[model samples]
Target: MRFFALVAASVMLLAVAAAAAEYNVVDYGARPGGRADDSAEAFLAAWAAACNDSSSPVMRVPAGTFLVSQAYFKGPCRSAAGVVLAVDGVVVAPSAVDSSAWIMFHYAHGLKIRGGTLDGNGHAYWACKSKTTPGRRCPHGTTTLDISQSRGVSVRRLTLVNSKNAHMAIFDCTDVTLRGVKMLAPRDSPNTDGVHVQLSTDVRILSATIRTGDDCVSLGPGTSDVVIRNIKCGPGHGISIGSLGGEAGEAPVRNVTVEAAELTGTQNGLRIKTWGKPHPGLVESVTFAGVTMRGVQNPIVFDQSYCPGRGNVNCPGKSSGVKISDVKFTDIQGTSATPVAVRFDCSSTNPCTGIMLNNVNLTYNGKQAKSFCKNAHVRLLPRVAPRRATAYRPALPCQLESRPEIRLVGLRLPVLCLPVLRLPVLCSCYACPSRASPSARDRAGDPTAGPAPPSRSPHLLVYTHMLVIYFQDILGCGKFKKLGLQNEEALQKCFGDIISVGNDHWSPHMVHGAAAASPSNAPNVDGNDTQDIDIDLTQDKATCEEGDTNEVEQISPVNANGKRPPRPAPPKAKKQKSGTALTIQEAVTSMATSATSYASTKQGKYSIDEVMEHVIACGATYETNEHFIASELFVKKEQREMFMTFRNNEVRFSWLTRKYMAKYGN
Candidate 1:
């Protein structure tokens, strides 16, 4: 009974703390319904009060349209349960443009922004920019919600629309979760990326429906462990890893997975793009699985030679050095607007490796799909597009010696040695029988020869074996003739420099005296048609000390294995083939003419015209509704509008015309 009383008392104290922590904007002099001096200040004051409370706090904004100007809710809250900004009200942005963010949540932990409409009045800025001709400039507005440098933050059930720039920019944060977020913008709006995550990790975006001009979910440099699931993105550039490696000293994006996504009428899908400049970073372990695309222009691509804003003028042909490896695309069934279903344009200097395409069935124009690859090692499963895929195999395995020999101590009696090429030691031996009557080789050679007693020579007791090692390649450094090491002196120097351990307690056989054989005229294994072979050793040299006898002499051709050392097989030669080798001018001309002229030749049921019409129709329904509502307010000749009277006794109008009428005249 005493323990039950203690539990009840603790529960009562928690309830009392929760009640004391509640701060409502109505009690703080907030006037909703489009008041000029709106609830922006009052809402901020309530957030401050609730954030300072020791218990879990709730700052509630009741259901009403609250006109707010640039407000920032800053926090390092004292609440253990964090501060919940339970906003059921529609927070509308002011028409007065500023360089500051419309709404920013900065430095907050355990923060939750939920249940509201964040309306950025971007129509005015879009109109001002639209009216500007050449040489005329218009000031652009800021992002809708700039949440930066906060950990353990969640923004849920929020409708963010008409952002001046990116809708929600999550920067330099960790453990951010955004669920059931709807980001809406015009398809033609410039630079309105939906959810941009940069310099952040462990970000999860679930059940998001994004319609915008730019990428739906863009992961910039230094982003990793990002999971995007159940996303429906359309009328935008689809999810992208980067336009990375644009500048020097940039961090790489790694371990990003986007699964169960449906992209309709998107410009691109599942893309990883790096700039044409050089960056010494790496993008690794990215997976795009269970993605469905409807009329996506480029369904899968890895463009290491990406130059976004700059067109094909003076492209320099310089590729990014950011090594992208271990990327996977699985279960991606889609239709591409263009004939090229998948393109992998990797770097020349830093070629991409370990790219896997599994169960990818993309079609173009009702015909079997095709792909284009450049400087990347790609593995494709049978279900992938282009049923007849000639997979990329490396031209050379490893620079190995043709005839490798090792030194072993010899006993007077022959010992049986088995071939151990695949073993670590490379040679194995067994003790010979001591009771043999005659020499085994002589007895086997002559039928008339009788068995003789085995000679017990004490001199054949034992010999000290010295370990001599030889290796063709270690790590990536080897003798490639293209690097200009051809002479005997250069070969010796290369061996001594490259194949050495830290200590000199042992001597490597190949390092001191080994000569490369004359390279065959046959082509090497690298996919290119080059005739030059890198490292091919033919001879081995072993030295014996003075006390070593004739039986245990160095450089013997035969061993106990009784098998002759086999020569290394020559690399199979293959010619590098390019299906589409056109210059930029030709590509541009082809793109312009391909739509009209190429449509007639398409064997598919839907023509290019039909595909484009379908793509445009995908976004027209929502865009049309938004345009219809926006046209009534942003008219050149405006009539009277309904004005709302706030509790602060301020009568305010809710349209762009309201600001225009107060400034100009009707």
Candidate 2:
């Protein structure tokens, strides 16, 4: 038994030693010291041996210069544990290699590449494409390192210089980390991006230094949840989010953050660009914070109509359809190489919105910089050093304008145009009435002639009653009922008279008769009860007769005997305790509840259009241009929070208005 046990122990120890194996390139016939002989085969042989190990394996390249050409490492290795490529030497790519990438790793899992220098020998390739070098067809230069279709990958302390194209590319990958990496190339190198990330997520780049001609870091379509911190970039186009929308059906880019970056003498500090073509993609929830720019040109930009070549030759003139929103630039202090420090050249068809700037200070040649904007909705918080252009204004709340006149219950009151509904509303509190004295025709032997308009003083209650009748009869009370505004008694108490007319017509004689019958039920205005006043119908009748000819049909509430008819009985009021004014939170809650209830009737979902309808029904008032209602809502903290929370829990309704969805939707 002792002899058998000793033999089993020896076998187990040998198996363990075989599992943790190391394969050296020199042992596999790799010639070092920058040999003319191709070393790609030796490196591949070493990788194949190491990858076949069932446990942790390391493939080492010893301390010497080696020459390789177009090496490809493909894997789903036998090892369940990780595979490591440890290089203590320099790898040089031969000149004139006709491949897309100098080195590529595809379908590799749990791969770690540590400590190496890769030289791409791109000087001849660059010179061949120069204008001075005539009649020379340039071969498509290769990227230095390309990793695709892999996960759990990390590259540390790697130095890549003079790549023909992009230095390093992370494509269709996840959970990737590139730290302590350095990429260097000439400032005039064509199309040599330092790092490019495309169709990837959960990518982190920390403590990287890049100097190149193209973008230091470029994020392509379908890239999200990326965090880039402590980057030192110069002599290149700075970080960019696109050149997207080049094709239809492209995915959106979202949730990206570039923080603690120092950009010196770059072409642009931060930029987002899209082609002038049709695409349904969108960008949102991105932040660029704590960035310091030194003499950067165009420190901030959003160019939706991007055309890459010189003079924008052969570029399409159509507007871009990619929507961009919810982007913030905070604590960005910079010096601009040009006078215009910030520019927003957004698409006219799909305007950029919900952009916020906080504590951004940019100077142009030691003076306050200038800004330019077109088709963008920007919110400038306090401490913005250079104010926006005169043509642009900070996004403000929506303002209901009084441009049309509405005839309600024989009173011609100015109507407010509700932006959400695009319809005229007869509410009295939203707009000041035309207080001009009654016309000569109205004053000619009219007993109802008075200095105060129907929207003010003793007649305000009557005007409000007219509004309730208009809403109930003309606008369909069932719709308003769903919004929690169909409570006749509550609306009356909140505004004026509590009158419910079942039909589409109201008469001044009915109001006078009701006041005459029940004096205590009348509203009190200016220290006097409305019941004590003698209401007249002559001016009301004349005003209605002389109103616009295109008004909606109205039925008179007068009998054939020229006498006022009795008012119809109002709806039975619900028995509820009276409450004090609501706090902001309570108001928002009430609005959300009403919106949810209304949405349930539609399809178990709600949108900004539906919400805005409810807001109008609840008598919410704002102040701004009519085109900015959705933007204003997103700018207000309480409303945005409520909407975001509501959207997260419920199914989103996609049939919202295009304008609202483009600016505020996810």
**What is each predicted model's overall lDDT from 0 to 1?**
0.61, 0.65
Candidate 1 regions with alpha-carbon error over 4 angstroms: 1-16, 308-316, 384-666
lDDT of 2 by residue, 1-666 (tens): 999999999999988786458788999988899649789999989888887877788889889989997677767688876689988999999887754567878667889999989998889878875656555577655678888667889999999999877788786678999999999999988767888887789999999999997789988777899999999999898999886775555668999999999999998889998877766679999999999999998789887876544555535565888999999998888798876677777887887878877777788778666565556656554442232222112211121211235455568754321111111121222222222443322332354444323334324533655444332222222334344433544433422321211111000000000001112432355466434665579987788767846587555578999887766766897765445434665888999999987766443233455455434422233432222444454333334333332111111111112113222210
Query: Which candidate's lDDT is highest?
Result: 2
Model 1 earns a TM-score of: 0.56
Candidate 2 collision pairs? 399-624
Error of 1 at 429 (Å): 40
List runs of model 2 lying over 4 Å from the truth: 1-20, 132-134, 309-315, 384-666
lDDT of 1 by residue, 1-666 (tens): 999999999999988887887898889988876647667788789988988987779999899888887677776789866899888988888765453357877667889988899888777766765564766555534678877667899989999988776788776679999999999989877666788787789999999999987789888777899999999999888998876775455667998999999999988888887767766778999999999989988788777766533353423566787899999888888788866667777887787888877777777777445455556656544332232122111111122111222223443322122111111111112222232243333343455554333333322312322111111111122243223233446334422322211111000000000112222542255766656556534322233423334565345376679865665666786765465644665888888898866653443333333322322332212344322332332221111111110111111111121222112210
Error of 1 at 446 (Å): 58
